[model samples]
Target: MLIEVEVCDVCRRLGVPVTSYTITETESGRSVVTVRCGEHAAPFEEVLGQPVEAVAAAETPKPRQAKKAATGRQPRGQRAERQVMTREQIDAAKAAGKA
Candidate 1:
């Protein structure tokens, strides 16, 4: 998540804490940017000129991680590849004393 925020100059001068602000450009050249709290926005705008809405840069979203499987065994399809003997093979092996 991305957020744009600034401190109030008036509050700073008054030794008071402030949070959240509206951003603006005060000059035609876009050289001066004014960020102030809501309480002082109108007053600051009266002096610096009406706020020229500033464009915020787009933030790229992060990629999500893939969840790992919790089971301690492989999928049925994968296990099917293993070789297994039938009952007859087992019996023959037992008779041959190789079981």
Candidate 2:
């Protein structure tokens, strides 16, 4: 038979098993681990001095709108074509005062 052991340092005082925990390291190469039950897990945010839920929500990306695909159909307006004019036709129109 195998037996489970609860060695959470934080919950040892309360005699509770650790279900959640947060481990942090300081600048001096010292590491600190805090183990707590589900109810006490929220208090870990006090170490960072901010609401952990708000931070997590803010960092999550919102869903984006789906992009529309091209239908391959031309637009409703008529396509315009360019007319090439020659110098002689221009001069004739100007001489006839039709320009």
Candidate 3:
């Protein structure tokens, strides 16, 4: 799921790695943003230490599956031999009137 939110200026100032942040919405219509900074973890219950509006979680659409080549056909190296008549064979067959 994708959750979009305005990054806090403080977090931006701290150079908080965005990859460690997560967003989740509860059944009560409340959104939670979890931040991990090294070994420390915190949840946003307030903005600037004051109770704030709830943030909604964003839903991401399922990704499409990649197409793959079909299996089970023989490889080129394992295919049956192609008909290739040698020069002597052709000459002999022509001399025998079977060309």
Q: Which sections of candidate 3 miss by over 4 Å?
A: 1-18, 23-25, 42-99
List the lowest-lDDT window of 10 residues for candidate 2: 7-16
2 versus 3: better lDDT goes to: 2
Please give the lDDT score at residue 8 for candidate 1.
68
lDDT of each: 0.57, 0.65, 0.53
Candidate 1 lands at a TM-score of 0.22
lDDT of 1 by residue, 1-99 (tens): 997444566564434445444455666545444445657676544544533442121233568997665598775446536669999999999999998
Please provide, for model 3 over 11-99, each residue's C-alpha lDDT reduced to its tens digit, 9 standing for 90 to 100: 44354443345455556666655544432433442332443432321233568997554587665446666879999999999999998
Q: What is candidate 2's lDDT per residue for 1-99, written digit by digit as tens?
A: 997666555455455656545465656676656666655665564545667797777679999997554477545554547667799998998999988
Error of 3 at 33 (Å): 1.9
Off by over 4 Å in 2: 7-17, 45-99
For candidate 2, what is the total of clashing residue pairs? 0
TM-scores of the candidates are 0.22, 0.30, 0.19
Model 2 local distance difference test score: 0.65
**Which scores greater on lDDT, model 1 or model 3?**
1
Among the numbered candidates, top lDDT falls to 2
